[model samples]
Target: MSYFCGSYPIIEKKALAGQIYSYTLLCPQIAENAHIGQFVQIKAEGYMLRRPISICQTDKEKGTLRLVFEVRGGGTDKISQLGAGDMMDIIAPLGHGFTLSDAPNGKVIVVGGGIGVPPMLDIAKKYGENCTAILGFRSFDRIILDKDYFATGARTVLCTDDGSVGIKGTLAAPLKEELKSGAAAVYACGPVPMLKAAAEEARLAGVPCEVSLEQRMGCGVGACVVCACTVIRDGKKQVLRVCKDGPVFKGDEVVF
Candidate 1:
């Protein structure tokens, strides 16, 4: 709930894919308290509202936070123009993040699709060899973070829509395979269809699951009604704000 708002210096920026870029910022205050699934509200120059970007990785000791984002529109296009050495405006760490299990588990599965892939990195990195990451993309060209996931020492499964990469299909097959072996828990973030399927699969498998909802936010914070999603909490349907209530929620609770 506690957050920081400031202009942080961009330490490094790397081009990941065609329109995707990774930025590392020097922000001690934000990095010091950032959690595995929290995000930052970044100010895009010349734009009225800030864009929400997930915290890809955070190094508390080094006082740095990494954000991987794609140039999706005018606001993000402006954000993409900034390079290393520029001061970036950000308010973080915002929203509820994933409730990560403190101890390492031999069986944990993390799923992500397209732009949703970035947030899964933090959990994969933390769980290391104990985690299995099933990542999906439209094609080989759209794929990002394969090497990065592998570098985390987590078992990485790659899937593409065109079969130009690992497996040509959705994450369903592999997810079911992993669950068959028994998973302690499942975590996911991606397109709603994907999230829904993953949540259902985990539910049927009787594995506890958590999912990060990908929502467009006008205020980044809970002030605006822009990011509302209905979820069944306490056996009742309740409207919730993705920015305030969560980007992360228990899988079965999501109405999607």
Candidate 2:
């Protein structure tokens, strides 16, 4: 059975960062089966394709699912206006998430840039003290979820390009320091540049790393090929759909 088999009612909406909004939807079915790093497809009032959004946090006790997203285009703008009691079509818990077992007891580092931190937040929550969260935004006004990460008791690092919040630099420099200090594995989600830089740092440091890719989707299910991505295996390139194979993939396997 589909987790989001019917329309869900929106319970609340709040701004998390600069131009970023987080919506909490009330759907018992979805809230029950939702997992960390999974996403949902929401059908806009007049749009043809549904907008895919990651599941930020699921509150089973309250039967709510929170989704955080950026307002970069038209589809998201329409979503930002939704208020309490608004109804939406959501198909949830889609795509493969991070492989948590890959790190086990080692120091697991999570790196996020801009809107990418939404998916990794839950992962850090589950890992508890063993997790290290590195969050970066363009400026101070763009930061989100720092307190939550710190509250997890995980060692949290903050960075910004314009010196607005934490360290004033790219995530790579501190990440290199973490790896040198012995972070066993790293997982990241963010812009292509940030993912690439994280992968490079991991490679140089000999740390195992995985990355979650963000791509446009026509359908959250496996039906459409709109979210196609290329992966390199055995020195050959193969095509994979982000909606089906993964929004999360091993950093070394993906072909930029």
What is the lDDT, from 0 to 100, of the residue 39 in candidate 1?
A: 88
Put down candidate 2 lDDT per residue, 1-256, tens digits, no spaces: 2455478898898888778988888887788887667788877777887888888888888988988888877888887778778887778878887777844857889999889888888878877798889988899888888887888888889999999788998899989988887776789999999999999899888888899888878877878788989999678898988987888888899987
Per-residue error for 109 in candidate 1, Å, reads 0.3
Q: Predicted candidate 2: what Cα RMSD to the true structure?
A: 1.9
TM-score of each: 0.98, 0.93
How would you encode candidate 1's per-residue C-alpha lDDT over 176-235 as one tens digit per residue?
999999888899999899999999999999999999987889888789879999999888
Return the TM-score for candidate 1, rounded to 2 decimals: 0.98
Q: Looking at model 1, how many pairs of residues clash?
A: 0
Deviation from native of the Cα of residue 165 in model 2, angstroms? 1.8
